[model samples]
Target chain A: MKRVLAVTAFTFRELIRSRLLFVWLISVIVLCGLDFLLSILSFGSTLQIFMDLGLAGMEISGLLVLLLGLAVTYTTEMDQKAIFLHLAKPLTRGEYLLGRILGFFLVNCLVVLGMGLVIVGLVVFLGGGTVPVLFYECVVFILLEMFVLTTLGLTYQMIATSMVGVVLYTFFTVFLGQCIGEVQWLLNQQLSHWVKVLLRVVYYILPNLEAFNLKDRLYDPNLVLGWAQWQDILLYAFSYSFVVFLIGWINLEKREFR
Target chain B: MERTAVVTDSPCAIQIRGLSKTYKTGFWFTPKVTHALKTVQLDVYENQAFGLMGLNGAGKTTLIKLVLGLLRPTAGSVAVLGGNISQRGVRQRIGYLPELPYFSKQHTGRELLGYFGSLHGLAGSALQHRVDEILDLVRMRSAAGLKVSGYSKGMLQRIGIGQALIGKPRLLICDEPMSGLDPVGYKEMRDIFIDLKKAGTTLFLNTHILDEVERVCDRVGILHEGVLKEVVPISKILESSVPVDYWIDVDGAEAAKLSGMPFQETVRNNGGVQVSGLVLAETLALLTARKAQVKGVRPLSSQVEAYFLKAIGAQAHLNRPIGGRRP
Candidate 1:
């Protein structure tokens, strides 16, 4: 436990100092800047503009966090041989993997939260009123979703060194996971019974990341989320993150330092 | 009451028996297993500076990795501090300094030590104390707060030693610890090893620096072709082992002519002829009988290298033929 905390602290400090963090923050600010400039044209309703701009910013920032997190982790330790110093001590592979995943997760969460706040501020200023309560709830879901994706991305980085592997795996887990249920239903309608069963199995195997995403629900009052649904999604996201970290831990355990 | 000095006989710091490691790589589905380490065994005592010498591709790094539990040996057992290295908690008592030390680019020397100290279960005031002590020991205290990215190669090496010493481990394993350092850096590392030994820390050092091995190590082991060929005390290697030629400054030409002694190899000189394999006592006896002025005798080791070469060549010749390969 002590080793975990020590490694986590060091990992967090490393994340903060990396150029990836600065680049991620600047990209979010740039998106917000472009959104503000677009809002001046009076193209749509204030809420419509705010929601569209905010969701886009959130998605882009999440992507930046994922790619940067993967790149920074894959190359830094390897190119520097810094991993040896840590492994040389009493630190276990499990503790080091956990520390890395949690550290990156926290950084991504903080970046997303900061962007969410900026979006809320822009909405209040444009609408000329206070931000809606649903915005806060949506922020929570967004935080949970980012946590899940970041953990999975970190696991991919540990298992595979290629950036392409991380990007491709993360894409399928996030975007394809959202469309899996629809794809399953479509496959059932078009294919034979056995193929439908296989497709359903495939759908169930994916992360179902769309379940935790509640951003669009903020504007649709009829699709309101109850506390039970929120709890379910939260539990699912946390468990998925835990499983990803477990895989990462096992992967690191089997790795030879050479 | 004063504690009784109970001497418990523990196994050597590292013991590997019949260890083997094979790495598979090929284009086909069926790969070829390259034998990186083959049936290698080594035992290093505590408080001894054991040097592992080998050329490239000799499995030196692989052996060290197995000892550190970084690599799983395909066969045999590795027991470190009386515990299986594959199991957890065995690493707490061992400190390793790798060949080329690297750090998290953002961490300063102090943070690196603190992290490693905490990893070894040191926390709070004790952890802080250890960090400070190690930093000062490696002479890195002044630059303790600078990020590691800005550190020079020598400074990085010093900080690497600091991290290894943070736990005050009973066993300190250093792999090529002086690889890229200048002469001064190398000397400083040697000094640190001496200090660690004084503190009763067992150091296992692996390097190709023959001179450094002679200066620091107590025992030296040579690794070749994934196997340990020889392990001898430093004293034996440093001393003249085989018969060496001696240069004796003696008296007159008449005295040299009078000497009908059997010198294995001889050369004529102005007064006294130079002879090979002449012991000091024999020379003194001859000089004393002749009542001639005798000077000092010097034993040369240049012939020792030739002897080693001949021995190695003879072994090679026995393996194959002079120019033909064994079918």
Candidate 2:
């Protein structure tokens, strides 16, 4: 446990010194500032405009922060061979992988909270209203969403060497996960019973990112999240993360550092 | 009688029998097999600095990696510190500094030491104490707070040694520690090796710097073409090839004549002469027998490179079986 904390702290220090945190900060500021301007110029339904712009900004910036965090965390250490120093000691592959994953989780959580605050502040300033509880609920779901995204990104980074390859693979999985609802609707229109079964299997296998989207109903106080629903989403996100983390950990254990 | 047989014990810090690592590179065309190490046997013991001397691509690093359990042995067993290399807990007492130690550039030297120290299971105040002690030992106390990117090559090597020595390991393995060091840094490293020896650490040093080995090592195993050519003691090698230098105060003509003697060279200076020969004792004896007044008998030392070349050359000539006695 001490070893885990030491490795994690050092990893966090490295991420900060790599200028990634600054990038996250600057991106959050710029994207939220632009969202504020869009809310101000909005003609019809100021609340609707603020909700649309704020949620869009939150989603885009949140995904960027997670992907950037994953890319910086994994690729930089690999290129520098800085992991060699830690692994050469008495550290097990599992400990090292857990340390890095936890470190990235902490960094991305901070990014989510920071971006959430900025979007909330912009919503209050432009729409002249207090932040709603549903916004807070969306924030929690986005944090959970980030956990799944970062783990999948880490899985891709483990197998792929090039940064572009990792980004493309992660983007593909995320896009597929996002479009599964639409694809399911389309498949329901003209499918035999067997085809429906196959599409249903695919839908269950892939992530249902649409469940995390709450922008349209965020202002409706009646749309509050209950305990059981939040628990199920959290469980699914954690299970997916665990499977990807296991794959990465096993590969890392068998890897020979030449 | 069936239960009375005796078993011989292995006498090495690491022992390997018929060790081979065949890496497959591709799925077709025989898989591009590379026999990195093959059928090698060696022994290293306590209080001895053992050198694995070889040129590049001679499997020196491969052998070290296998012994450290960084690379799995494909065909044989390796026992290090009396424990199987494949076992989990034996590495606690071993310290290794690889050919290239990759440190986080953003980590200060102190933080790096603390990080590695904790990995070795040292905690809190104890880890911090060890970090400070090792930094002082490696002469990096002032630079402890400096980032590694600002350190020079020599400073980096010193810090590498510091990290490897944090546990005060019983078996310390250094791979190419002296490469890319300046002369001052090389001498400083040699001094550190001697200090570590005095502290009772058995060193397994792999280097192409033969001179450093000759100066500091007690025993050396030369690996040539992936084969152990010799495991000669330093005392025997030094005694066999001790060089001699003498100054003959005789006239310059006699000095010139003395220079022409087989295998002798003369350096002239006004009325005196300085002569160097392959062996000083034989030359001194011959001069005394000839009634040539020897002003002084001084000894000269040969560098390890010259000594290594001569030794390898002589071994090549002595390869044949003995034909007859010198009757």
Candidate 3:
């Protein structure tokens, strides 16, 4: 347990020293700039458009940071052999993997919550409006989405032999995960038995990222953010993350660091 | 209370039996299995520097990885300090410095040591004190604040040794520890290894440099083509490799006078005759009788080169560079 925390602390310090915050700051600036530009260009209510884009900006930044973080740490841990320092210790491989996931999630939190704070702060001071409760809800859902993506991204890093492969696999998986709803839609329509079974298998295999994606439905009148919905979403995220984490652990166990 | 030291009765730091490693590469449909290490047998005794000499593709690194628990052996077993290498307590007392020691470039030397120390269950003042001590021991105290990326190769190697020593390990495993080091750096590292040996730390060095092995190792195991050819004590290697014949340069009349002597095999080149298999005292006595002016005496190392040639050239690889087939 002590060794696990030590690895976690070291990983966190490593990400910080890598100056990941610089990337976050730049992302936040670009996101805010785009929000400001789009809110003005669109003919809709400026406040509504800005708030909507700001919420999206939060998710985009979190996902972006998670993707970039996985790439950087993968190079460090695998390509540059930084993992030798960790694995050479008395720590187990599982503990090392968990520590890395937690550390990456923590950084994602910082970016997500940092961008959240920026959006909320800007809405309150600049836009002369009170922060809506829905924004915080969106942030929570975005964090949930990030939590699942973090495990999946790290798992991809564990399985991929190259940086380009890791990024492409994770990105395409994310795209496919979000399109699981479309697959379900196709399933509802007329389809062959084999096609239906394949789609169902893929649906169950890949995570439904859109479940935690609340930005699009923030303005929906019937959007449910009740305790029952919260319980289901949290359970799904934890379950998906655990499975991905297990896959990553298994892959890592079989890996030979030559 | 301190845990029971498992190494109390065991005389060997590392013990391997029929160890083999085959790496599966290429595509999934047609997997290619490359035998990195054949069923090889070797041991590294405690409190001695054991050098594993091999050519590039001779399974040196593969064996080291198996011992380090970074790779599972395809066959056989490896035990460190009388226990499996996977045992956490056992690993805590084993320090490893790889051939290409790449660290977190973002971390300073002190920070990197502290992180490694924390994993060994050290923290607060204990971690800091140990990091500082290691820094001083590796003579990197002044540059402890510099990020690892800014460090020179020598400095990186010093910090690598420092991290390995942070745990005060009973066994130190180094892969090519002195490769790429400058003369001064190499000398310093060799001196450090000697000091560690004096302190009773068992050292396992994987290297292809025979000269370094001859100088520092107490025992050497020659690995070639995944096979352990020989594990000889350093003293025995020196004795086996030492020259057996003596050559002398004498005046022409003196050489002619010495030609009939049973111990003298005369060399006609440069107006000097060669003497083979003559004891130094007897040759001097014979020279004194003949009124010979001794110009020079050269000791031939055909015996030593003979041993080396057999060990490395067993696979008919006399021309291959050290470590076997690596580019």
Worst 10 contiguous positions by lDDT, candidate 1 chain A: A42-51
lDDT of 1 by residue, A77-177 (tens): 75555777677677778788788777877787778788887877767775665666777777777778787788888788777756677777887777777
> Which is superior by lDDT, 2 or 3?
3
- Please, what are the lDDT tens digits per residue for candidate 1 over residues B1-327? 111121225358887788898887786887888888888877787766778877678888889988987788888778787777755576888888988787778778888888888888999999998888888788888999999989998898898888888887898999899987888888888888877777778778888665667667777777777777777666665464544445565555544543576542343344543444536567667767767676555543233232332333334322222122111
TM-score: model 3, chain A: 0.95
Q: Would you list the clashing residue pairs of candidate 1?
A: none
lDDT for A212 (candidate 3): 78
What are the candidates' interface root-mean-square deviations? 1.6, 1.9, 1.1
Per residue, candidate 2 scores C-alpha lDDT tens digits across B140-186 of: 99999999989888788888888888877888899999866788878
Tell me the TM-score for chain B of model 1: 0.73
Residue lDDT tens for model 3, B62-90: 89889988999999999899898878999
lDDT of each: 0.73, 0.71, 0.81
TM value for model 3: 0.87
Two-chain DockQ for each candidate model:
0.55, 0.44, 0.64
